[model samples]
Target: MQDRAEATRNAVLHAAAELFSERGYAATSISDISERSGRTSGAIYFHYTNKEQLALALVDAHFSAWPSVIARHDATARPALEKLVGLSFAVARTFRDDVLVRAGARLWTERKSIDIEMPLPFVDWITTVERLLAQARAAGELAAQAEPSRDAPNLVAAFFGLHTLSDVLDDRMLIEDRLANFWLLLLPGLQADPAPRALLARAGGRVTTGHPARVPDGTER
Candidate 1:
C-alpha cells in the first residue's frame, strides 16, 4: 500500500510539473493535474494541501537532486573554472529537457502571484557558483581584477536571463548557444591569460557530457 501510494503521488507530481511548465503557475489548476495524472482530487490533497504546496513540492523535487549532481561533478578533480563551465552546460540541458526543472524555474519567475518565499533553487545555484568562482580565483585561473563575490552574482544573473529567454522563445538550443557565446565574451575579461576562444571551445565541449546519476525516485530523466 505504501508503494502504491508513493506511485500515485509521483504520478500527480509529474502531471502537475507538465501542466505548470506549459501554463505557468497562476494558470494551472488542481483539476488540470488530476486529469493529466488520472488521479482523484483526494489523492492530490493527500500529498499537498493546496496549489501553493504542490508548486513548492515541484520546485523542491527539482532542486533536491542538484546537490548530488554537483558533488559528483566536483569529484572529477578538474580546475574550478572548468568545473563551473561544465556546470553551466549541465544546467542548460536540465532546463531544456527536465519538465520538473522547467516548472520550478517558471514558478520562481512567477513567485509574486504565488506568494511564495524566494525559491531555494536559485539560492543554492548562486551559492555553488560563488564557491566555484572563489576557487577559480584562489587557483589563479581568474584575472587579477576578477572578484568572485561580484562576478558570481553577475554570471548567475546572465544565466537566469538567458534561461528565461529560452523559455519565452520556446527554443532550448538557444540557451546552449548563447551560453557558449557568453563564456566567450566573459572569459576574456575574467581569465588572466584571456584565452577566451580556446576556453569557450573547451567549455562547449564539456556540455551534456557528464552524467550525474539519476535522481532516485524522481520524475527526471
Candidate 2:
C-alpha cells in the first residue's frame, strides 16, 4: 500500500513537472496536470495541497539536487579541478534532460506567483563553488593568481547564464556545447597553471557523471 501510494504521488509530481516545464505557471491548471498525470485530482490534492505546493516541491528538488552529484565526484578521489569540470557537464545534462530541473527553473522564475516562500536561489551554489575552488587552489590544481572568493560567484553566474540562454535560444540542446565552449574560453584564465588548465580544456564537452549523473556529478544550481 505504501509503495502504491508513493507511486501515485510520483506520477502526480511528474505530471505537474512536465506541464510546468512545457507551460508557464500562469498557463498551467490543475486539470492540465490531471490529464498529463492520469491521476485523479483527489490523489494530487492528497499529496500536494495545491499547485503552489507542487511548485515549491520542484524548487526544493532543484536545490536538493546538487549534493548527490557532488557525492559522485567526491567518491572518485580525483583532483578537485577534474571533479569540478565533470561536475559542470553533469549539471548541464540535467538542466537539459530532467523535467524536474526544467520545471524547477521555471518555477523559480515564477516564484512571485506562488504564495509560499521559496528557497533563495544561487547562494548555496556560490558557497559550494568557493569551497571547491579553494580546495583546487590549495591542491595547486589552480593558479596562484586565482581567487576563489571572487571567482565562485562569477562562475555560478556564468554557468546559470549558459543554462538559461541555451534553454531560451535553442531548447537546451546547445547547453553542453555552450558550456564546453565556455570552459574552453575560461580555463586559460581560471586555472593556475598550464597542466591544471588542460584538465578542463574540454570543459564544454565533457561529463563527470560517475558521481551520480547530475554532480548528480557542480555548482548545484
Candidate 3:
C-alpha cells in the first residue's frame, strides 16, 4: 500500500512539473496535472493540499537537486576558474535535462503569486559564483583589477540572460556555442594568465547544432 501511494505521489509531482514548466502557475490547474498524470484528483490532493503547495514542493525539489551538480564539479580538485566554466555547462545541461529545474525556473519568476517563502532561484547561483570568484581572486587566477563582488553578479547575469535566450530560441545547444563565444570574448578580461581557455577546449565537448528538443518530462533522466 505504501509503495503504491508513493508511486501515485511521484506521478502527480512529475505531471505538475511538466505543466508548470510549459504553462506558468497562473495558467496551470489541478485538473491539468491530474490529466497529465492519469491520476485522480483525490490522489493529487493526497500529496498536496493545493496547487500553491505543489508549486513550492516542485521548486524545492529542484533546489535540492541543483547543488549536487556543483558538488560534483568541486570534487574534481579543479581550480576555481575551471569550476566556474564547468559549472555553466553543468547548469545548461541541468536546464536542458531536468523538468523540475525548468519548472522551478519558470515558477521562480511567478513567486509573487505563490505566497511562499522560497528564495529567488538565482540568489543561490549568484552566491555560488561569488564564492568561486573569491577563490579565483585569492589564487591570483583573476585579473589584477577583477572584483569578485562585481564579477560574480555579472557572470550570473550573463548566464541568466543566456538561459533566457535558450528558452526563446528553444535550442539549449545554442548555449554551448554562445558560451564558447562568451568565453572567447570575456575570458581575457577575467583571467590573469589567459591560458585557461584550454580548459574549455579540453572539457567543453562538441558544440552541436540542432533544433531544440522540448524540455524534459521531469522524470529523472
C-alpha RMSD (angstroms) for model 2? 6.7
Off by over 4 Å in 1: 115-121, 204-221
Residues 129-157, candidate 2: write the lDDT tens digits.
88889998889878777899999999999
> Which one wins by lDDT: 1 or 3?
3
TM-score of each: 0.85, 0.88, 0.87
Per TM-score, what order, best first?
2, 3, 1
Residue pairs that clash (backbone atoms under 3 angstroms), model 1: none
State how far residue 120 of model 1 sits from its true place (Å).
4.5
After superposition, candidate 3 runs with Cα above 4 Å error: 205-221
Q: Is candidate 1 or candidate 3 better by TM-score?
A: 3
lDDT of each: 0.78, 0.80, 0.80
- TM-score for candidate 3: 0.87
Where model 2 places Cα greater than 4 Å from the true spot, the runs are: 195-197, 201-204, 207-221
**What C-alpha lDDT, on a 0 to 100 scale, does residue 110 get in candidate 1?**
84
- Mind giving the per-residue lDDT tens digits that candidate 1 earns over 1-221? 99999999889988999999888888889999999999999889988889999889877877775877788769977888878888888888888888888888778778889866655556677789989988988898989999888878888989888777666654464567566766766888888788766665665543332232123354232
Q: After superposition, how far is residue 160 of candidate 1 from its true place, in Å?
A: 0.9
Q: What is the alpha-carbon lDDT of model 3 when measured against the actual structure?
A: 0.80
Poorest stretch of ten by lDDT in candidate 2:
210-219
